[model samples]
Target: MTQKLAGRTAVVVGGGQTPGATVGNGRAAALTYAREGADVLVVDRDLDSAEETAELIRKEGGTSLAHRADITVEADCESIAGAALDTYGRIDILHNNVGIVPAGRTEDLAAETWRRGFEINLTGMWLTCKAVLPHMRHRGSGTIVNISSMAGLLAGGETIAYNTSKAAVHSLTRSLAIEYAPHGVRVNCIAPGMMDTPMGVDANARAGGVSRDDVAAQRAAMVPMRRQGSGWDVARAALFLASDESAFITGVVLAVDGGFSLRAGIQ
Candidate 1:
């Protein structure tokens, strides 16, 4: 069988991961794209971490490069597009997997914290899209995959900042999809639920003052699949959205969750 993304070039933003036992969504997506025969640009605010991902891909005999850019910065986002075009001469796929889970209730949340969350989770995505859209429109075809969370859809989360911003991502995806459909650009989103990523496990463990295994088990039990999802699970979903296999699909919010979202509002 032919590789789904053969001869394509993919730009995977937020490609670095937190230190933990599991892979991150961005790194996994970048690797998955490479494995399927796409040259990759692994971008992250953390230059060292980005290089680590790039090095891993190189070790696997895949073509990849590391780039540093803070998504919150407009110029940096523009540079991301520029770098990709300079390196590969064209941009085929753009996968956004950057997010932060800031815990706080609406009543107690700090103004700065809420602003920061929106800046990173929402505005950053818009900026990246803004930077890349011109190039894509010029070419008349491209694919963009934005990462969201089930928290965005489900109610009752105390993390107001995370939930609201991610929810906005859903809106952003659909809005871009319709606006750019005529230009032949497809925009889609993935909402991951109960993932066992470093951000999900390690961060939660530290914040909750519990063992990582305990945290993992607790989250897994809530999932209908009886297990928390890994980065690879989300990566596979991103792969489908970024490839021509889903050429006819767009403006979709594909949930990578394991039925957790399905149980929303139940006792």
Candidate 2:
């Protein structure tokens, strides 16, 4: 390993993932960070699922620990930072990987559901940053990678709540980046296209009442690359944004969509 993150500590929120044939983005980023020599703290709402990810890292001779936290709760977000500090001493990277898709059109979407989606997809992210920003700012250095979606940039999806919340994430990333730049902190967002993770495929399948295979095929067909990207693709991108390689970059929303964004154009 090149050890891009050697001696660094990373907090990967939503490190646990939905069960599926393929890995999810959070799990992939955790493993990738570990592979690059970063001790990781895996946070998830599900203790068992989080432990599963921690165990995988341990099996690979990488250091990791699991913690459970409902990020929507401000106190729980504080606990995340506390756990990372207690385990790793200092946080060098904060990877926000939690997002939810509640499929609904604007007119049909429930007010409560819309609010809940924002709480998870956007507000929770801000809280986590709030939890860790002091430490990063005090040290005068840190990196944050937020996982957004192409839906935030383009139109055509019925997932009104998801699209709007993710769009807010883009704005949030830029806002934080500029605010913290003088303090030596960097904030960036990744807008992934159709990914072939269990969450992506399984959720669509259930929503469409179709087989997973059918859902996967249709999503792949939509992408310009003729295939859906994987968790590893996003992981590598996160790795770059988290590592020193992207030291000069911040507040940028990178599209890891295999040209899908180009085909769709901007909204």
Model 1 superposed RMSD (Cα): 1.6
Encode model 1's per-residue lDDT on 45-105: one tens digit a residue: 9999999999998999999999999999999999999999999998999999888877788
Give each model a TM-score. Answer: 0.97, 0.98
- Alpha-carbon local distance difference test for all models: 0.92, 0.95
Cα deviation at 192, candidate 1, in Å, is 0.2
- What is the C-alpha local distance difference test score of candidate 2? 0.95
Model 2 TM-score (2 dp): 0.98
**Model 2 lDDT tens row, 1-267:** 799999999999999999888999999999999999999999999989899999999999999999999999999999999999998899999999999987788888899999999999999999999999999999999999999999899654588888889999999999999999999999999999999998999877887799999999999999888999999999999999999999999999999999998888663
lDDT of model 1, residue 12: 94
What lDDT is reached at residue 173 by model 1? 99
- Model 2 CA deviation exceeding 4 Å by range: none
